[model samples]
Target chain A: MIELFSDLFSDYTLRTVAMGAALLGITAGSLGGFALLRRQSLLGDAISHAALPGIALAFLITGSKAPLVLMTGAALAGWLGAALISSVTNRTRIKYDSALGIMLSVFFGFGLVLLTYIQRNPDANQAGLESFLFGQAAALVERDVFVILGIGALVIFLMGLFWKEFKVLSFDPDFFQTLGFPVRALDHLLTGLFVIAIVIGLQTVGVVLMSAMIIAPGAAARQWTDRLGRMIMLSGCIGAVSGVGGALISSSIPGLPTGPTIVLIVSSIVVFSLLFAPNRGIVFRKYREWKSGKQLRVEAVLVDMYTLAAQHLSAEYPHSARVLDVMSSMSGPARRTLGLLKDLGLATQLDAKMWSLTPEGVRRAELIIQRQFGGEE
Target chain B: MEYAIDIRDLTVAYREKPVLWDIDLQVPPGVLLAIVGPNGAGKTTLIKSTLGLVKPAAGSVLIHGKPYADQRVNVAYVPQRGSVDWDFPTNVLDVVTMGLYGKLGWFKQPAKKEKVAALKALAQVGMEDFADRQISQLSGGQQQRVFLARALVQDARVYFMDEPFQGVDATTERAIVDLLRDLRKRGKTVCVVHHDLQTVPEYFDEVMLLNVRRIASGPVGEQFTEENLRATYGGRVAFVSALVSGKK
Candidate 1:
């Protein structure tokens, strides 16, 4: 652990790779919140897959492997794939998802073919190009870090500038239209930013695991908060932590690759949030259910006591506590609740076997009945 | 004076059959109107087409003598509650602030003025106390009021509400009715796609009974008769059954 922290700061290669990975995480994670909210979580998957062809084709056409050139090529190809998906869905009876599947497979398959072609006609330059498939985070120098940083900043700025429009369009495009905003333009802008986010991550995270960077952080963050602003911020934080942690861990361990390691860390965060987040987490929800059930048990005992008192025409008429065991639907000893009720002064034990509601308890039980029958429900 | 809403020869279709067939309608200024019909009668389609949310195959929609696009500022719409995901991670005030997004347009953020307007609108719908509450925590009626509050923030001259009272509690129904009357009093035009025909005479001043075609439209006393209702709802028996069921 000490070595990892020490190396994270001093080792230049590790530092550069960490910065690049963190940039990819923040960009993809924040924008991925919108994509998730827009019900287009899988869009990242399709676009990232389609970017493989763009990366290969850029090298083929330009014969240059500059970060900017390759990234621009990848962004254009990713944008074209997204555009084609829309056109096919709009023009034909084909569904949006099916069109995505078609574009993803076709572009990726073509990219493989191009990659093989380049591989056969190999020069030393072509050797490192194949690393784009899985990504060589260790090979990411300071220059690559700058490129990712520049693109990530641009994407974040665009998101902030058009924050309201992007938010409204994601939530309700029809309502956004009624508000006199250009729905299509905002949509294209968001999708364009989405493509940029995918492209910037291609070198460090690679196309295969880039979609995970986009989706996992946002999804995990969603479990943490009920506000979009908070969700986006939290997602960015998770992504940063995952990126830095993944880079350090992958560096310290000899065989573990950085891209997949980052993916694993992000995925673990998602699993953790899914189980442990306070509001939406599975564990919290189960805890809430269990807590509510306990409350219901106490309420049932109180109400059952009230029913008996009412039947006897006296609030103080002590009845057999064993009768509550028969009256209550919840599977627990009715006597177990007396301690709680006694603490609240809502019930009193007249004897070892008998109990009755205090005046307050009777009032509370009546209110509960009224709520069940007549109130806001 | 120009009619608040003027739709002419509007037609919308899914596939073979048109949902709305050459429909022509108009609403005068300062009236509470209810668009009533049986299920599958293009009630929602009418509102969508008018708001330019849905494309009409053949027709034109006008707001205050201008095309809808030109007059969107003076128009507010509340779509069906079921149309959006309630579990969406937003507080009540944020959703209400969306109503003012029209004024902000693009690139500008909603500030103190917008927040105050949203809060006032929430008060109008009796949801002021719930302004900070998450949308997912709301009851069905509270959700309906939030949607109403959103529309109210628009503060438009013409309002289009598509079944705002669906699945709401009696309090919300009363609140919505009082709100519609208040809108009418202020000379703001309000049209609601309503399901409960029993409340037609008590709630709406003007009624538009529609099927695939325009059956009748006018004051409730004249156009809301059994004869027109029968034609709009496919004969007397179905209409009676629909009324007995209380919701269509």
Candidate 2:
């Protein structure tokens, strides 16, 4: 284990893999941020599945998995699928989701049939092709890593340059169209970049799980922040961590699929963020609400005591030693209420265990009730 | 006088159902015209055809005596408030800046001047304070203001707005009307698709009443009378009168 750690630090191949994974994560995550916000989160799924026929066709035509041919096939198929969905939705009455659903199933089904035929055919010498389904990172060559990094850098640069246009089209497409901007073309460009990211992820993360890499990190980051720049950056960071962490862990464990492992890691990050984020997370928000309710009840009790005692126009109540009198002034869950106030230092135990409101506690309670329910009669 | 928008027998159809038929209208420069109709009266389809968003089946849309393709930059549009996804992750400033993109053309980012114009438009709509705020954080009125700001940055000679006051509050409606009047003063032709029947005279100088067909269109004095209103919306009353007069 120690030797493997040392080797990971020193080996150039391993270093290349880490850098490649990080770049891919950043690219896919950034584009995924917009995709998730556009409520087209399932676009990643459709594109990844659509890329399969492209890969298969490219190899069948060229008889080799040449980088250029593979990318061309992937980009062509991806663009075609995206354009088809859009045109179908606009021209026909068929809904967008239904169109996307049909495209995904048909394209993926065709790709599966083609791939099976290729695997059984005697003329096809494609080795390690099945790995695209469930990625085998051990088979990723140095050239593959370089391709991922190049596509990643290009996507990031394009995103920066057309940031304003993309923002306009996604938010107010009608306004964008009104300004004579080609909103349709901009949409195609965004979807194209997303397809490229999915293609790069396919080599190692595989089609089955690459979709999660494209969506989960962005979805998780969305839970934490609303700002676009921050959300994209945070999503990139989360994707990078999941990618690199999954790669490292899978490399350590024998016979484990890297694609599923990475998806698991990405989903775990999403789960962690959804539950524990400060403002929007489920658990923390519930906790804050619960704590506030408890505090409000205590304040309500003190206010009741304060108002009751104020009738006497004195600092202390003569019959303050009676627990039943304090309890009688309040409503709803009295047993739970008295115990909470006593526990909160708002009241003190007197002789025979009777309770009296503390001065600090009395001041806090008086302010709350006065502001909330001030002499409404 | 340059006619900003000139339509010659404009006919548009959707799936063999004619939405607009043999419509002829000419909008002169520096005029603020409002198109009023009931629900599904093809008001949107008219503006869309003029903007080249929808293809006309048989007529021509000429901008400055030319096709819209030649004068695309001279025309700007503001669609209905609910037509867009508000939850998108873009700020108001970014949206407004896109108005300059038509002038800048492709592959070029908006310059500092464009940004300044966008900011100026935002100020005009009292939305300068929220220039950097995400569009989702805005109210319906604020959202309409941002879109108006975007169209203002377009700096077009002709403006087409489709139901711009649909979901806006009274204050926003007034602000938008004032903005349109200001645009008219600046010699820009503004065409608005309006729905309110009560505020037609106060808000618009000219009115075009439609009911999937041209009912009456001219100055308010000549075209917007009870006769015109009955033609546009009083089908049953017209039928009863025809029967009583022994004409039907």
Output the number of the lDDT-best candidate: 1
Q: Which residue pairs come into collision in candidate 2?
A: none
Error of 2 at A287 (Å): 5.7
- Model 1 CAPRI rating: medium
- Best candidate, DockQ: 1
* lDDT for B139 (candidate 1): 96
Chain B TM-score by candidate, in order shown: 0.95, 0.92
Please give, for residues A315-348, the per-residue lDDT of candidate 1 as tens digits. 7678887898878746588888877899989999
| Per-residue C-alpha lDDT of model 1 across residues B164-232, encoded as one tens digit per residue | 989998998999999999999999999999998899888999999998889999998778876788788
Candidate 2 per-residue lDDT, tens place, B1-248, comes to 66888888888999899999888888888888889877777999999888777888988889888888788888888888788877665688977887787777766877888889999999999999998897878999999998899889888899999888888898999899899889989999889999776667777777898888888887765676766777777663444334223311
List each model's interface RMSD. 0.9, 2.4
TM-scores for the candidates: 0.91, 0.83
Docking quality tier of model 2: acceptable
